[model samples]
Target: MNGARGKRRFLLALCALAALLFGALGVWQVELPCQTLDLIERVDARVHAPSGPIPPRSSWPRINAKSDEYRHVLVRGRFLHDRETLVDALTERGAGFWVITPLRAAEGPILINRGFVPRGRASPSSREAGQVAGEVTVTGLLRLTEPGGRFLRPNDPAGNRWYSRDVAAIARARGLPGAAPFFIDADASANPGGLPVGGLTSYRLRKRLLDVALVIMTSPVTVPLTILGALLVRITMGAPVLFVQSRTGVSGQPFRMYKLRTMRPLAPSEALQATSAGDVRITRVGAWLRRFRIDELPQLLNVLKADMS
Candidate 1:
């Protein structure tokens, strides 16, 4: 039939586009999955090693989450108890505050995340014993500063309320002219007062290599299906056959997720927060795509693109 011939031609065009994309993006991404186990073992060795010297200020600018974050490091400094900031936290111990205090180290002032203190013991007076006044040695994991506040809730420096541990914001608020851009999460060396608990950081390394393998293995069926789906979307809807969504990835990085457009454009007055199942914005074609979960096919490309989430 004429319709079948059109579909074959459309598929060839889609294949050409995919080939161009692969050529541009460097498509052989299956190496990571094969090396994932080896990578995990290597990371474990580095993470569990004995405390080492903190990266000097000269090299701070070169520090990165990939090479330096979570490395065990040592620093000796006097705690500036008065300048300590408490950021809201929820740990295994329950809802509490992370006591982020400035340490006057020889290199410079660096923030030390003393640890979580329960809500009832959030006041400094309640955990007085842990607040050592004299010079002390802190041996713990070095952490990269989390800049922007947590999701939806931004830090209020004026009001002294912090939802996340932002280094620059805290430094400005506490009047530290020169402070390190990173912080240290103190190890679980028992504090005298036993209020703020340390060494509660969790390290979860995602294994996205298998995602690459899966996509490569299923490409035969998936490639054709994706092209077919795109064609269907174009015929059913109008222009802009793909819907792109912004999502958070590893270490608060933003990524664009691709999917076949299923819903009609929403009106300006519509709520952007949530879309209900019965919402009028859902087109008949979109409803069908949702029912069969065909809209997820395009995400196979996300796996190839170094982010599988």
Candidate 2:
């Protein structure tokens, strides 16, 4: 009788533990989902659109030049010849470069992303063939200039290498003053064949698997074990299990963003040289680490570090 009673107690304790863990997982899921789009939406609410004609000259947004509030300006300007900068860009089509030309606006110089050109268009002939001349009207999304380069690589103006659409950097490199706080996303009608394939602006938020997984670890042991696994991976790899490269944030300022690294360290220029499944450049441990997202544990640190802000 005592044995059966003890067995019943054990079973009840197990059930209670299971219930507690599931409840904890459900709570976690409610907290840490992808909030990028949520933050974007909140920002969008604060930005009031321009009604009717452009606001008075003095009423324009102040240009410490570091806010997305300046985006979506409808400006009329002429392209400045010989001052165009080709920036490295990627698109759904393929990887290539962009033709960011300065548009001489009455108020200030606004950079216009003319369009995308493939690697084959890496010459003057290709640029000339696609150049649009004379007075023209362009209406596209105004993006705040991202000054620094992309993926932690600094923009080397001397080498003509650019990876981000930082207007201030480009303007400074081109030796132009009075540059606008933002750049325009050239519409499809402006340069259809241009690199980056203009009109590639639609962004949708997707539910991340990590968010789901974390939320499901409701069991007390499961949550702690998962967290322990993540911690173990981080301890094995050094401080940053997830690496945040300095990316050009809105309006030419620098911000660090997170990503999982699957490659061994190399010369800065040689970063992210693509590796297939069997590539030798990846460490055996890192490869397996990448597969299971043990490499991504550092992003929790990133999140705690408030790098996303």
Q: Considering every candidate listed, which one attains the maximal TM-score? A: 1
Estimate the TM-score of every prediction.
0.67, 0.56
Report lDDT per candidate. Answer: 0.79, 0.59
Every model: Cα RMSD to truth: 5.8, 10.6
Candidate 1's C-alpha runs over 4 A off are 1-12, 21-28, 31-42, 90-95, 118-120, 150-153, 204-231, 239-309
On the 0 to 100 scale, the lDDT of residue 256 in model 2 is 68
Clashes of each: 1, 14
Q: Which tens-of-lDDT digit does each residue in 1-309 have in candidate 1?
A: 999999789778867886775554344334543465455555566569998999989998899877887788999989999999999876657778999999999999999998889889988988788889899999888888888786566899999989889999999999997899899998888888785788776422224445555776676567666766776788677678898998864424357889988887666776374878786787888887778778888987877775553
Q: Candidate 1, residue 143: CA error in Å? A: 1.6
Kindly list the per-residue Cα lDDT of model 2 for residues 178-284, writing each as its tens digit. 77656777656545234335544422011232333343343344445444443443434444444567755322345666655555556777776766878776666
